[model samples]
Target chain A: MKTPTIRDVAQRAKVSLKTVSRVINNEPSVRANTRERVQRAIETLGYLPDLSARSLRSATSYALGVVYDNPNAYYVISVQNGVLSACREQGFGLQIHPCDSSSPRLAEELRDLVRRSRLAGLVVAPPMSERMELVRYLAANKIPFVRILSAAEDPADGYPCVYVDDRDAAYEITEHLIQLGHQRIGFLWGGVSHRSSPERFKGYESALKDYGIPLDKKLVIPGDYSFDDGFRGARRLFALRDRPTAIFGSNDEIAAGVLAAAKSCGIDVPYELSIAGFEDSPFSKQSWPALTTAKQNTEEIARHAALRLIAELRPPGDAIAAAYAKNEGFSPQLVIRDSTARARLPAAD
Target chain B: MKTPTIRDVAQRAKVSLKTVSRVINNEPSVRANTRERVQRAIETLGYLPDLSARSLRSATSYALGVVYDNPNAYYVISVQNGVLSACREQGFGLQIHPCDSSSPRLAEELRDLVRRSRLAGLVVAPPMSERMELVRYLAANKIPFVRILSAAEDPADGYPCVYVDDRDAAYEITEHLIQLGHQRIGFLWGGVSHRSSPERFKGYESALKDYGIPLDKKLVIPGDYSFDDGFRGARRLFALRDRPTAIFGSNDEIAAGVLAAAKSCGIDVPYELSIAGFEDSPFSKQSWPALTTAKQNTEEIARHAALRLIAELRPPGDAIAAAYAKNEGFSPQLVIRDSTARARLPAAD
Candidate 1:
């Protein structure tokens, strides 16, 4: 059987080629009665508009490219779902491209994707946010992109980004612990270079200062976001001469790892050592005692970012001012679970 | 600047468009000198074919569709890796489309994808596996697909498939525990309706018979391959007055849940009771006493299925047979980890 075409639709509808085009493009001048005929013809003929072929007819294709490198399944999946939902509503399709710096021809490869895909917009993820050369290349090429998490402190000057107040979430979490009388806290930070780490650390520091507790540098250790790193870093926390009574891990995987490490070492959780994590991932819930963490609302944030990208690419029929009026910057919510507990006071000698 | 075309290459090479195309397609009988000239012209013009656009012209698209229903991260990720690797090797782009029974207009939706995406082939995963109606629909439509674990008994009867020999693996594992001195054994079962479940149960039953241990109906409990099921099922095991010293869980998540359930109940693992699991997932290795489970080689199987799909889709010019010969079936390897232990003697009367 032959593939159905626009020609087939035109013939089946008993309409001229131009009339069929008008019906497909939803040109307002077409009579409602005639439009229904064309639609019926499309249904009967099972004629799917060759999306890419149709794009070739348009000056700009209705497609956006998403280039990501994040390893967190929940975060990535949420973002993909959000983007797909937005794309579906907008009559567009997303081209999801996952790349790692390990691709030998990384620069050339991304550039090739940009050119070949003929993408109207891009959704960039870390650590591509830190790839200045790639960013500059995209900018130079006049490509519009929305950065999910820019390593830059202030893309404020130029680049548009959907961001979280990581520092604020960290501060709130710390304060929550402080209220529970936890002073000797062990902070496990994500890599020192990422912008979120320093900001989160600052939040932890500020909470301690506000509570009039002297900050101890020895208690703060850098931890990569991996679960193994969590285990190793938590072990270091336990090795301290004045070991922390409470531990805060950078992410859920790390937090779970910390819990596992504590379990292996015979440390009672939320009793001898309270623990907490960030990014309320599936891992957080799956872990024993569950993790007290921050809810980033990743899906919602991703939807907002995708919507913003689509709006930037092709202005919707609605007014930009009205859309802006409805737009609100989001904040990460704190999810308190069983991981954290009241400070265990020293037993009487 | 400007986009380069095949016309630009022909113009640069001072040759006919046909001659340039012959070099591009690597057709036989192109003079070496002419081929070199064409290659040089192409390089100078920077003429990389726009695959989406070209597919419309030649009707040979570099796109494959991945259709699956399950939301399990481990399974999805493994399948994605396999499909993507195969697609990349064939210079194709992959579109991952997840579906379920509840998705309204299933046939129409799939047909719509087939029509719009210009897919060369497809990879389907369960519980979409059990949807024989959809399977027949796809076959009737003349679309090529590789079903992942669809047929338990006959793999090649309907279409090409990559199947796991879970029954055999389950048998050996159960037998291993028996050899370790366990008389009474517990079995945790997943959804019985699944095609794989009955086979796994058969292996367990037959293995026990060979070892002369009477099958204890009281010790077996129904579970799903999930954390909650494991937690609930293990509690039932704990409640039994004459509980088995060793328990076998259906999968890793259930195993983890069993471990968690034990920890919360103050029961020591492997010391007082032993537990085993199937599917050596990342969670298995990361679990407290890493799961002693069957290594499904999910990644390899996925790669194999994908390779098969691509081989089957190979064009007249391509060496389809050789490509298939390169990748045959891969068996699941048994990984003995920390989850299982020697069965302890029952408590003295």
Candidate 2:
């Protein structure tokens, strides 16, 4: 079958070619009823408007790319969904690019992608967003993009970003445990490359210092953000002659591993040991006894990042653009579940 | 910074306009040395070839869309990764579209998307792929597409699809349990809309019939593909006076829930009760006792679907197209883990 054309749409709608064109371009000259008829006719005939012609006239590509290098499937999906929602609302197309952040040619690859795709802008996700050098490269190249990064405050480098305060959230989580009488707490670190890991560690340290509890070097274990890492880290802690009362997993996956490890060792969670996780993911709720963690609104953060990028592309003074111009920041709030409780006093010596 | 044009690339490579064009078009007439020089210059200058001009001359859009309506983040991410890999190899841009299959205007929405985006083709994921009405509409409209679905055998409706043999895989799983000397086994169903649920149910029933065990209607609990549902269903089964010694969750998420439930109920898995799950997702291994499941190569299946779609878009008699012309089918293989074991003979009453 031959592809349907704008002329076919015009003929089917019983309107002139110019009127159909006006409706396709979203020109306000067309009456509402006429525009509806044209849209119905277009859908019925499945008429494809010439994108090349439209792009040339507008001098802008109606699409954006989202670049990320993350292993967490849930986080990636949430980011995609958020960006998709923004694109859908604005009548723009979205392209998801999952890349290896460790690649030496990362900048070159991104430049090539931006040039070849003719993308209007980009939403760069962490840990790529945390790399100041890459961010500077993008800025120097005049590539329009927004960064979603973990930071206590803006870097003040003139680069637009949506930041999450992992340090503050971590501090709050630690404080919660401290209040629950957990003096000797074990901390499991996330991936080192991500700025969030260090930021969270700092928060944990500050809380310990404030509580006048000596931070134990042995209690802090280095591991990536994964279930296996959490399990291994927990096992290491469990093997110690004097184990901590509470274990804090940087993320939910890690915490879940800790829970599984505790179970394997016949240690009752919240009774014999307390396990806490970050990121209130779906499984966090489904886990037996549930997990107490921080509720980071990843989808919302990603949505704001895309919106900020789009705002930069739009003309200044545009209503939506102006609304999104201000940089956004988020602080994950602690969600108390059954994972944590008062630390039991040591058995009578 | 000024956007570099093709002329700039040609000048940098010390080549004429025609030579640069040939290199950009990937014509065989261009020498390898010349192509390499042109490519390096293009990358260094960050030149963007006029996609509209190239698309117009060739009459092809270098973009495709992957449409899905799945709740599983892992499954969705795998599909996206697979499609992205194919698109990367084929020099095509990919758009990810997550839509509601239950929408009444799903067909109209898809038609508008295809028309507006001018996509070369679409990779449709289930349960949208399972809807014959929508599939027929695309076929009738001459919209190029490939579907990924679950079936015992190809429907052979002429429409190209990649089918997973859920029935066969389920049959193997059930047989494994029956061989373990389990007479009364509980079954959990996935979403009713997805054909896999019924297909898997049929396989389970056949396995029971073959083993000369009567189907206990009360033992089969109707539930969707979710951890909550699995937990609820398991709780109900445990409440029964005559509880089954073995349980088969339709998918890994369900099985995970069952594992959690068993822990809550103080039931010893694979000792007093046995559990098995389908789909070897990451969590299955992370679960306390690793699950025995059917390993479905979702990424591979999705990749084949995209390759087949791209093949359809390529010119006839093309070598790559020829390789992907044949319809693909898959049977998930059973993976034995700690979740299952020989059921001990019931204690003498």
The CA lDDT of each predicted structure is 0.76, 0.89
Sequence-dependent TM-score of model 2: 0.94
TM-score of chain B of 1: 0.91
Clashing pairs in 2: none
The lDDT leader among the candidates is 2
For candidate 2, write residues A1-349 as lDDT tens digits.
5668788888999999999989887889888999999999988876777665566556687888999998888899999888888988897788789999999899978887877667788899999998989998998888899999999887667899999999999999999999998888999999999999999999899999989999999999999999999999999999998888899999999999999899889898998788889988887887877899999999999999999999999889998899999888899999999989988877621
Error of 1 at A109 (Å): 1.9
Candidate 1's residue-wise lDDT over A264-331, tens digit each? 89998877888888888776776677789988787777777777777676555655323532323556
Q: Provide the lowest-lDDT 10-residue window in model 2 chain B.
A: B50-59
List the candidate 2 regions with Cα displacement exceeding 4 Å. A1-52, B7-19, B28-48
Q: For candidate 2, lDDT tens digit of each residue in B237-275?
A: 998999999999999999988988998898988787889
**RMSD, every candidate, angstroms:** 2.7, 2.7
